[model samples]
Target: MAGGRQISENKKGLPRRWRFMHGAYFYSVPPGQECMWDGKKTFHLGRGLPEAFRKWAARMEQPGKIHTVSDLLERYLLEVIPKKAPKTQIENARHVRSLMAAFGSAHLYEIRPRDIYRYVDARSAKTAARREIEVLSHAFTKAIEWGLIDNHPFKGQIRLEGETPRDRYVEDWEVIEALSLSAPQKRGRRQGPAGLYQAEAPDRPFTWGYASPAAGCEFPGRWHSGAVS
Candidate 1:
């Protein structure tokens, strides 16, 4: 502070900036010695005046200027991915971990459109990869909302939409097959006995076989065959 005259307050009596930032909020240990909150915290400023403090702070305040892949990965998992189903979230977390293992230390700014495009292609080939891509896309979308990234790499990408077709639909031929009873013995309308079909007895399980086309079979033989009333 140099002990000079105290600067006057701003419009709201709050100084916009201070010379010596106070508070010893974090502790340090020897290198390679594990700290309880290592790799999961943001309190690493030390006693020396950093030459790149302004640049670093500016980047930190930037909407999505994460310096390492790990930072973005953690943020995406904790903030965005969990909003989906638990199964989906777990899968995305696994994919994100795999991606980081592949390139964890890479700087975020260093990742290019080509890199992301390659990622899309690679992740699109498998179910897990596709799900991971979806989650990654979601996180990137949020980053765009925060003014972090400019655009989504998965935009306009060709991928599966996860749908299964229904087989219940029957064509006209199928409906005819279902109602193929003979016309003479048909309980309902019969086309002059030509369309009449007789189902066999219940001797065998589901033994109701359709009558042969060449030689029509007897209908139960209990009364006049193929004769109504």
Candidate 2:
């Protein structure tokens, strides 16, 4: 369901009114509802509109006040949690990037489950979808506090399972393969992601961004430490 926000009025010089979609709602004040200036409105996008979004539409439309998603997040960051922790800020930045990177920076009022899923899927492999979506939910929670918007889209939604953290340790071959592709070095007889070895450049940072169980360069396996590639 796409929630489209609209400014309804016969205001002169207006570009026929603006319409924007979020999810499961189509907002628009039928012409003549404009009291002084064009007023914005939100409404259910489909028959099976979520109760939450329906309620949101009712409140926002009964007294039309539309805000963009980014606008809401900004208010949430500074105005709502002025004293937010440094770690939290960092996480927010990371998660927010995943969201925007998944979806373009459109009017925030237009995000939908589709966009949300896209975000989750895009970063699901790298970072668990649970934390990624959770962080986004926190942003919406803050928005609620600031009265910018209600209803966290992630609520009641299925998230990646929360089990004991899983390990994505790559194998010797896998590691060498990835490393070879990313940080290509003197390709030797070695193959797989394992051949991804760098000459002992104790001076250089670990050539690989993440670690694998290989060449002893990896944890517990660190063997010939003389800069095992």
- In candidate 2, residue 224 scores what lDDT? 28
Number of the top-ranking candidate, with lDDT as the measure: 1
Worst lDDT window (10 residues) for model 1?
A: 7-16
Model 2: CA > 4 A from native? 1-66, 80-82, 162-229
* Native-to-model Cα distance after best TM-score fit, residue 56 in candidate 1, in Å: 26
Tens digit of per-residue lDDT, candidate 2, span 1-229: 1222111111111111222234223435556754422354533333222332233333332323436544444443333232434334344544444443333234444554444443433332535455556555565665555576555443333333333554654334334323433222223213223212322333322111223647645221111233554
Q: For model 1, which pairs clash?
A: 181-196, 181-197, 182-195, 182-196, 182-197, 183-195, 183-196, 184-193
Residue 12 of model 1 has an lDDT of 14
TM-score of each: 0.36, 0.36
Task: Estimate, for each residue in 41-120, the C-alpha lDDT of model 1 and write its tens digit.
Answer: 33343322221132224223323556565667656654555354533443455576656653456554444333343343
| RMSD for each of the candidates | 29.2, 21.2
lDDT of all predictions, in order shown?
A: 0.39, 0.38
